[model samples]
Target chain A: MNAIEVKDVSVYYGNLCAIRDVNLNVKEKEFLGIIGPNGAGKSTLLKVILGLIKPVSGEVRIFGKDLKETNKILGYIPQTSGFDRNFPINVLDVVLMGRLKNRLSLFHRYAKEDMEIVTDLLDKLGLSDVRDRQIGQLSGGQLQRVLIARALAIEPKIILLDEPTASIDANSRSQIYSLLKELNEEMTIVVVTHDLAAVSAYFDSIACLNKELHYHGDKELDEETVEKIYGCPVELIAHGVPHRVFKVHEEGYDD
Target chain B: MIEAFLQYVFLQRAVYSAVLASIVCGIIGTIIIEKKLVMMSGGIAHTSFGGIGMGFFLKIEPIIGALIFSVLTAIGITTVRRRTNTNSDTLIGIFWAMGMALGILFIAFTPGYPPDISSYLFGDILTVTELDLKIMIALTGLVIFVIVALFNYWKAYLFDEEFSSVIGIKTIFLEYFLFVLIALAIVALIRVVGIILVIALLTIPPAIAKLFTFDLKKMILYAIFLGIVFSFLGLWISYQFNIASGASIILLAGLTYIAAVIIKRS
Candidate 1:
């Protein structure tokens, strides 16, 4: 059964269509990468699925249930830009937020199990030492790991991340990909990213978006689809190897 | 100061006002700084002037007017912000100016001897009445109660609003609830520091506390303690120099923050 099913989804900002009539499906435990250029509605599509942004018209289902009913099953790692990094919250407290599902009592306390889950995730993400440090003090890579730990703390059936490795060192980038690759064995993963090199290496499936669903299927994308999604993108390289992504140019083509 | 507190009801009320103002300001001010809502809070503070003017025109207690105006402005700003494309700071500026304009108009139209509006614009803590004290007590209780009860959710919301909503935390409700709390906190401080200087009291203590701690609860406690100290020190300074109480408090807090910054860097 599909873990996520999005049907006829469209989002608009004013009259500008952000994403249009995009339909996609991800089976359980599948690793899906969404690739698109800037302003291509990649982030918008993720927000729609997370129910953070209401699509102009669409239906999103997780495990055959409505988006609202599937909150506990969805773990999201949003891009870190939208919030104050200097906020006075320690790493442990930030990760512990994932356990906030369905526990809305006044004066609620974190269960003992909640702490264990967060602690374990922190250790796995190599964030144990920075557990008590302020989020503002973390490097980009460390902050990304904290967000990953937070997402995992939900014990989600499906995890979604937006640009998870956007602003980190190359070494940390590979570490994160490997971590996600390990986690993929247990849960479905959907990532929106601009890292084409990592895309082919990590994602079992890929979706190309440009304000609409240009392509959605396996990792082997045709050159025509690539050009259509990026508008001007002509070349693609994967995994530090010179992989042919575009049609070979004619000898007389402009240099 | 101890003997004076026992002798005069007004002195007792002033001390009470100082402590009460510190409590709400410490709590809500930390949120204001953390959430980056300082300008919006200032806009709310300035807009309450219209309500104060309305109270004078209607012959009711001015703080009551200030409360109603601030709550409405908070709702207006939040709603319009969500539905419209107007830049938030621009919207805040509009509300800020409109509130002041309305206050000026209301005060001009009121007949009889012009009331001493300086106390509202620049708070006269020495003149805090029984009614003001009661209102401050109620608001302080509500602010503390709400914050403590929703502490868990608030941390999440402040850290990452979008992720919190995805986790089913009722973020919209939290957003509106927070704005209203800000309004209440502003009104609660109006009698102690007045409108113009209230922002300082609301912001400075928390800003100082932030330098010392990274934990939210510890930061709040430190802010409250700092707030009380600044208020008492300013109160003493004002009494000794025969100067404006509100101005003294704000100046002391401001200078202390600068000193703390310098010391930390050193």
Candidate 2:
């Protein structure tokens, strides 16, 4: 069964079509990467899948259930650049927020079980040392890890991340990708990012998008598809390493 | 000061108003600052002036009018801010100007001589009646009840609204609810510091508290304590110097905010 199914989704921001007639499907436990240029509605598409933005037309299904009914199983990590670092909250509290229920009760408390899960997640993410420190005190790398821990605290079947490694250092970026690779063993992972190098290296499948999904399925990105998405002549984004380089179409290109 | 309180009911009511206002302002102000809604709050506070004017025109309790106007304005601001691409500050500025204009119009249309609006404009803590005290008590209690009941939810909602919505936390409803709370807090504060200076009380104490603590709960507690101290000091200064109580209180808070910043820096 597919982990996510987006059918005929069209989103508009004040009559400007953001994502138009987008159809996508992700298999369970598949690591998917969504790449697009700036202003390509990449974030908008992610928001639509998360049920944060209402599409003008179409439906999203998660494990054969409607998106609205299946929100509890969806964990999200938003762009860290947009976060308020000065917010008066600690790592423990931020992660514990993932344990919140949507019940209609006046008084709610975090149970002992919730604390245990948060503690274990903090330990797993190597964030136990900064559990009590305010979010503003953490480094860029640590903040990204903390957000990841928060997302994992929900024990989600499908976890989504938006620009999880946009501004962090290369070492931290590599660490995050490898961590996601490890977690992909148990749950479906979807990421929207501009990091083409990392996407080629880690993602099981890649989707190139520009106002609409231009290509989907497999990690092989042809030059024509890249041009269709970016609308410009691009340079060598993929480097030859243990990872597969792009199947070069030009005669003089080296592996 | 002790003898004065014993001799005067007005002085006693003033102190009660101060303490009650402190509790509400401390909690809500922290939220307003954290959410970066200070300008919106100031806009809401100013718009309530229209309600006060409407009250005078219709021969009704001005605070009730202020409450209605403030709440309506909050809903309006929240809806427009969320649904439209209009610049937030531009929307707030319009509301602020329109509210004051409406107030002026309402007062002009009233048949009788203009009422002495100084108390509503600036504030007269000594003018607080028993009914005003009762209103303050009820409002303070309501504020505390709502906050306590939804403490954790509020923490999540304020931190990351989009993520909260993705997690099924009803971010839209929470935003509207928070705006209404801000309106209520502003109304409760009207009789104490008047509309113009209400934002000062709402923002200053919390700003001071933020400098010392990073915990939301501790920030509230410290803001409450700081609010009480500042109100008392301002009250005493107003009494001793024969100045406007509202201005004195704002001045004191502003000075203390500067001092706190300096102290924290070094």
lDDT of 2 by residue, B177-222 (tens): 9999999999999988988999999999999999999999899999
- lDDT per residue for candidate 1 within A189-215, as digits (tens), equals 999998877876888988999988888
- How many clashes would you count in candidate 1? 0
- DockQ, per model, reads 0.74, 0.72
TM values, all candidates: 0.96, 0.96
- Residue B27 of model 1, lDDT score: 98
DockQ agreement of candidate 2 with the native complex: 0.72
TM-score of 1: 0.96
List all candidate RMSDs to the true structure.
2.0, 2.0
> How would you encode candidate 2's per-residue C-alpha lDDT over A1-255 as one tens digit per residue?
999999999999887989999999999999999998898899998888888889999988999899867857889999987768898999999999988987546888999999999999999999999999999999889999999998898889999999999889989999999999999999999999988788778999998889999999888877778877988754543333222435655544443
In model 1, the Cα lDDT at residue B38 comes to 97
Report, for every candidate in turn, its global Cα lDDT versus the true structure: 0.90, 0.89
